[model samples]
Target: MATRIDLTLDCADARPLAAFWKTALGYVDEPPPAPFATREEWAAHFDPPEDDPDAADPAGGGAWLCDPDGVGPRLSILRVPEPKRAKNRLHMDIRVPGHGGPAERWERIGAESRRLVAAGGRVVTEFEGHHVVMADPEGNEFCVAAAPA
Candidate 1:
């Protein structure tokens, strides 16, 4: 059997970036941990005292998203102190299946690219064979590729 895997992204801010990914990938926020009914309640658990920076940002920490139908791997985005200074060593390639032919596949890829751009992702560049390199709002690079037949 194939091993199941989860994905992680390191970024400066987790919430907004995770939100962007959520929209881009049609994923939903993973529910708050057990014993907490909602995200607000979970966040309230870490509410900082007065005069604390955490009071503004909250210490609840990070963001996780998962495929709603449980078909795809989970995605975890964690907060990091430093900015990304170089290209990613590993990156995701968003795969859009080829529907009928090369033309249809390219069209679908274009449509999805536009949707991602509308959701605060930018197409950094395009490449051969229906591939478009894109960057999230935080400038993390990934690609949207037309899946092979």
Candidate 2:
């Protein structure tokens, strides 16, 4: 069987970043495990003892997102004390369907770029008819590209 994978991102805050990613990738907040009413309720099952110095906060600061269509990998945004200091070694490319000719493909790419920018992403550079490099609200770099013909 093929293996499935999940992607994780460390951020100063998780909720907003998850929101931006959800907009960029067409993802939705993943629900709590079955039989659990909410994420907090599911987490309560693993709560640490009161005396433990490293006990997790009941109000956690992470967010989990998944593709609504169930084809893409899950995304986990974890809250961390440190901020992003450098460029990401790896990044995601948001691919839009490439139909018609060059002008049409570029139009589709541009449209997606504009949508992402409105959703808290910024354009880094544009490759004209090729692709547009963009950054999330936290400055994590990604790209908006056209899918294969």
Question: What is the TM-score of each predicted model, taking all chains together?
Answer: 0.82, 0.89
Residue 59 shift from truth in candidate 2, angstroms: 4.8
Q: What is the lDDT of residue 106 in candidate 2?
A: 96
Worst 10 residues of 1 by lDDT: 52-61
lDDT of 1 by residue, 1-149 (tens): 99999999988888889889998889999998899987667877874668654455543357889999999999988776678998888888898986688878888888889999999999899875579999999999999988777
- lDDT of each residue in 85-108, candidate 2, tens digit only: 999999999999977899999999
lDDT of 2: 0.88
Which stretches of model 2 miss by more than 4 angstroms? 48-59
In order, the Cα lDDT scores of the candidates are: 0.84, 0.88
- Candidate 2, residue 84: Cα displacement in angstroms equals 0.4
